[model samples]
Target: EPIVEEMRRFLDKGMELQRLVPFAEVMAELAWLGEGDRDEALHLIALAEGLAPTRAVFGGLAAWRRLLSPESDPGETDGMAEPHRLQLIGDWRAAAALWARMGAPFERALALLQGDEAAQREALDIFEALGARPVAQHVRGLLRQSGVSGIARGPRQATRANQAGLTQRQMEVLQLIERGFSNKKIAAHMAISPKTVDHHVSAVLGKLEAVSRGEAAAAARASGLV
Candidate 1:
């Protein structure tokens, strides 16, 4: 998915502008690093920096720029947040531990992706378990670049066979839908990207043969799938 598209989803959810500013920075950084849209990334970075010109945010933007052009020094990490500084400095093991303590599985996995092959493998598993296909693909690319062999070429088998073909993440999304949780709520509860939640929701609807979330919930209850 386009980084801007995901960023737009966050904006459409009516979250606080302050809370969303960081995500804009994150998506901009991802775009710069992950073969996403450079022009959009620059636009987003400009917008976010204009909105929240905090030292922490500036440090993050500067760090990402340094990553893109390694010869330029990534100046002092004095003002950057601990997690952002750790990940940008390639100390992903420490960053992963910090995210784990904070109960952010997706972020922890992202940090792990910056570590050794073993750590990257764990990151891959976490991404797949969360149904974050885009990040999982990115992790796969990293593993391949590191000369690791025998990586699985598809979703885990358990994800394919569980609960009438509902992946574990999909089942979680379905249960949340049954409880009338919006996609944003489900994303928050699962600690995964809203984009991943969207994919799971679509899959759940398709597998349950329902036209809407309410109908899907009713079918799931009628069939004991939830």
Candidate 2:
């Protein structure tokens, strides 16, 4: 059966999604599907309503869930307050404008999808420019439905992960990490210093939106990137 169909039945049955699991584990799995499961995602977000006082995974997930759901209130985003405020108020054009100024191509494109015709076209351009094939395809479908043809599809020169915003160097570092290489070994293999390898690892973590090397490696593998 379709996962979404199964999930709907499961939710309807009132089955305990967290049986024998902690709230964090449940939230972790749901976070990846938040876009498709906004109702449960909102429930999970409510479980951790207040942002944790520190840099914790639960807090991060909660904030991300809030951002994905327009029904939810504005949440912190490492300090992108005004754009989020505009988003909360349903002003995607204004929010996207701020996102562009903030150099957040992903969020900007997402906001543009919510905006007017010109904004949607700009979003499509940004998605194509970023080599984000999947998102670009979705936006293309939307544009085509709106009777837009002759849109430039730019060169889709990169891998499927261009949407991930990871640099090539970071991708290499992540590959080595998945092979169980430590910093020193990765540095030796890459012909770079250990400190540099550490930097690359950190960048991989940030780009993957992972909290640790292990989680980043798991995400890379899950995405079939290695």
Best by TM-score: 1
Worst ten in a row by lDDT for model 2? 27-36
Candidate 2, 53-156: lDDT as tens digits = 43233433543554455366544444336665566557777888888888999878777777777888888888778866545755766788888888765565
Give RMSD to native, each candidate. 9.8, 14.2
Assess each prediction's global lDDT (C-alpha) against the native: 0.70, 0.63
Give lDDT tens digits, candidate 1, residues 1-226: 3454566677778755565666656655555435344455555555655665465866556545544454655555667888778877778888899989998898788678667888988988998889776567656766788799999865544432253556555677888899999999988897766765776787678667799999999998887776
| Model 2: how far residue 225 lies from native, Å | 18
Q: Quick one: best lDDT, which candidate?
A: 1
